[model samples]
Target: MYQYDGFDQEFVRQRSAQFRDQVKRRLSGALSEAEFKPLRLMNGVYLELHAYLLRVAIPYGTLSSQQLKRLAMIGRKWDRGYGHFTTRQNIQFNWPKLEDIPDMLDSLAEVEMHAIQTSGACIRNVTADQFSGVAKDEIEDPRPWAEIIRQWSSLHPEFTFLPRKFKVSITGSSEDRAAIKVHDIGLALKKNDHGDIGFEVMVGGGQGRTPMLAQTIRDFLPKSEILPYLEAIMRVYNQFGRRDNKYKARIKILVHETGIEKLRSLVEAEYEALRASFIDLPQAEVSRIQNFFTAPPYQNLEDQEALLNQQAQQNTGFGQWLQANRTGHKQPGYAVVTISLKPIGGIPGDISSDQMDYVADLSERYGFGEIRVTHEQNLVLPDIRQDQLFDLYQDLVSQGLATANAGLISDIISCPGMDYCALATARSIPIAQALSRRFEDITSQQNIGPLKIKISGCINACGHHHVGHIGILGLERKGEEHYQLSLGGHAGFEASIGKIVGPSFKEHQIVDAVETVVQTYLDLRTEDEIFLDTYRRLGDTPFKEALYAAA
Candidate 1:
């Protein structure tokens, strides 16, 4: 994890102080609600359905033990005793009083964390692969680049107010864990034939009322020129992106309205013009940032294949968790462990303060003293030794964190819905809870295999429903809550938007409707075919027939 230097510390303190005064002014009646709106948003505060929501950025999803402990402390002291991890790799505290947020910001500053850029129409938190440095298939670690972008983009005067909010995601692995295709700017780190590292740049991917996968703008851009290239893209968007309507203000809309070829040419022209003037970080600073993400000290030990096999055979729960939650690591004796936040009938990403402290301790004891927040709303211990898997699993089980359902139907990604967000049309958490309970049987989920069910309360797509294998969107029809389903959406190397299956279902009928789709897949699928593969192979005809004909 990147440690904050004096300058970083000073900058955060100043921002916190400024926001403290701003909050005071608002509370004192010196500013009206309308006046305070933009000010509060700039500091990552939102006036939600019931209370103020404070969103804290976890840049590139990296956190040290100390930072995690501080977050736990903040949750315990200020708002409720829990925080909600979000799809953007951020954390949201939903019940904080307006007056207490300043203190909360000050507390976060003590741990080199802040709420900056977590909201507003500015560049938001930069996200990366949860297993960035440890993934076996990584060409190079992307964290250094992510950190570089964080420093460069934070409070950049030119991009502080763009046409709309922008997001950037990066991944170093051949497998697309970071969902790069759905970001405003997606960077894939790869090496060319000569073995020199660079980025494959894609632009205009997003999900909302309109969903589109990003298109590649540059096949190969030298790693050193990334900053200037990004600047060029932002300049183009800032100049020409729609500003009249908020719905069409995103860069994705600009790319849609202006053809990709024309946009690419404009960006190229801008890049050429800025090539002489744009000052990039020097090699020394780049190396300094890279040093922060070097691999932790690892011991050379044999793999624990035999021991793990023996233990899995002894306990079915352990066996299931081992198969689902563990991922391959670059080190011989290490594994990346994902702690699933979505337990059976539980909220998808809510973690209590105690659980946060427990995870911080486990990170230090079982692996490196670092934790990673995944885009899927899960926590990861990136450097856990393979030999200690059972012990860690037992600890996670005791804390109700070992849900053995990663990448399965039960491991749902859902937004807060009407429960928290004022923008939501219907309840999302209940839908997720019902779905999890519906498929509570571990055997059934495993049989289904590698299914992602993402649910969003509304078309804003906060839950990333557009990319789920089975996507659920909740909408209010007439006076009742209704849910719509989309099938075959994927957020991977072959990313594509899901298609609506049929007319929406009533709230009570949603669970049964989803079950019908699943059963249809199970009945028609060939050997070893997952829901997505079968759907792709045979389109949406069979699933539609099963869902509507039965209705």
Candidate 2:
């Protein structure tokens, strides 16, 4: 939770005022729709399939109670009574009127939030692990670096308009919760053999019409050089990345066309030049930013192992939630509670205004008055005391926020497909909902184990379908919605893109197809093997055969 300083405040205010004027001109016909299109996009407003969608960035997916409440208010006041959280860990107001967006932006500014860089072909939101500082396994918190990038990239004149959009994701832990490998630039924070912190820098990782995992450009870059090196990479891309074709404009394409060795050489040369110009961030400035992400105070209490075991014996529901929705925290007697938004047959990541307000209240009372949005489209109370788990679960259950399926088969990651996005080729939400219902049994889900089902409506891969254990990509075959299945995709320390199984299935047949694939894995899997591990061991032959057997 980096609070906005005076400079930050004033900058947002001026930007808001400028946007307000731009919007006014567009509405008054002083600016034509053609001229207003890019301007509105730069501010995170999009003309969607049925209405305007306003995407608000939740920086590194962190939110204070006040910020969460403000998002709830914006959802209630400007658009429909709910907002759609996306795979990028941002929230989207799906029904906002064009005229009301400026007001929405102003309201967001008041909460140190905004829609800037959430859309268009500029540096988008810099994301990190939702459990950054709280994760027990993390080497260092990654948000400070993410924040540094956010500040540097925000309206940077040099990178204001690139050939294509760029994304950067960071992870502080060995586990790749942030999916760093699939970003335009991925930074993994780690300690070297000498106990000095640095980054494992990867570049050219992306998914779209073409999917490729990022390759390591530097094994261990000194922490002090992150910004300058990033600038160098961007400079290389901006100067040489293709501008003639939108389809191939991304840096991923540039990296593909030019080998990683050459790209690394180019970036290193640029970095060497920039490092001499006093452009690297000073150690003092880095320390100042790092101070904001320091851990919160916690009472020295005994571990909750016995208490949790006792509670599990008493309440079946709380027991299930605790098993699936909780992750160990850095502090003893505390846990990071994931509030799953993907309830069976519910719209994935769609939180109603009332639910948002209640969660905000719960964050203040039970946690640290802070919330986190995960890339998997869930909310997290990162600092919840283990002693209060029962009470929090009951409250979340009442609000329809307790699903007990955080990383289970039912916890699907999906995008707003043809239902909202004009770029989508098919419907994604209904597919997600159907699959959730198909696997609604909690026992069955637990039996299936940590399965990730990510769906995208098209090849743009907004749902991160490329990285799911069982990836589903929705496309229109002829005139009907069809889903093409993929297997063995994973997003972790060992990241890999899923491989296509066989022909696409029709909309109605997709649920059954997924079940067939899962059942195949269950039959063939060794003891304790999850869907991904089984797939990796067995490959696509078994799943593909089972998937097309019914056809």
Give the best candidate by TM-score: 1
> What's the residue-level lDDT of 231 in candidate 1?
96
Residue 465 of model 2, lDDT score: 92
Q: lDDT per residue, candidate 2, 1-551, as tens digits?
A: 79998999988888889899999999999999999999998989889989988999998999999999999999899977999888888999999998888899899999898888898899999989999999989998999999998998999888878999999999999788998889999999999999999999999999998988899999999887888889999999999999999989999999999999999999999988888784667788788888898888888876798899899889888888999999999898899999999999999999999999999999999987999999999999999899999899999988888899999999999998998899999999999999999999988899899999999999999998999998999998789888999888888779999999988889888899999988999999999998888988989988877877666
The TM-score, computed over Cα atoms with residue i paired to residue i, of candidate 1 is: 0.99
lDDT at residue 324 of model 2 (Cα atoms): 98
**Full-model lDDT, candidate 1:** 0.94
In order of appearance, the predictions have TM-scores of: 0.99, 0.99
What value of lDDT does candidate 2 attain over all alpha carbons? 0.91
Stretches off by above 4 angstroms in model 1 are none
Candidate number achieving the greatest lDDT relative to the actual structure: 1
lDDT of each: 0.94, 0.91
In angstroms, give how far residue 310 of model 1 lies from its true place.
0.3
lDDT for each residue of candidate 1 in 215-324, tens digit (9 for 90 to 100): 99998999999999999999999999999999999999888899899999999999999999998889999998999988889999778999999999999999999999
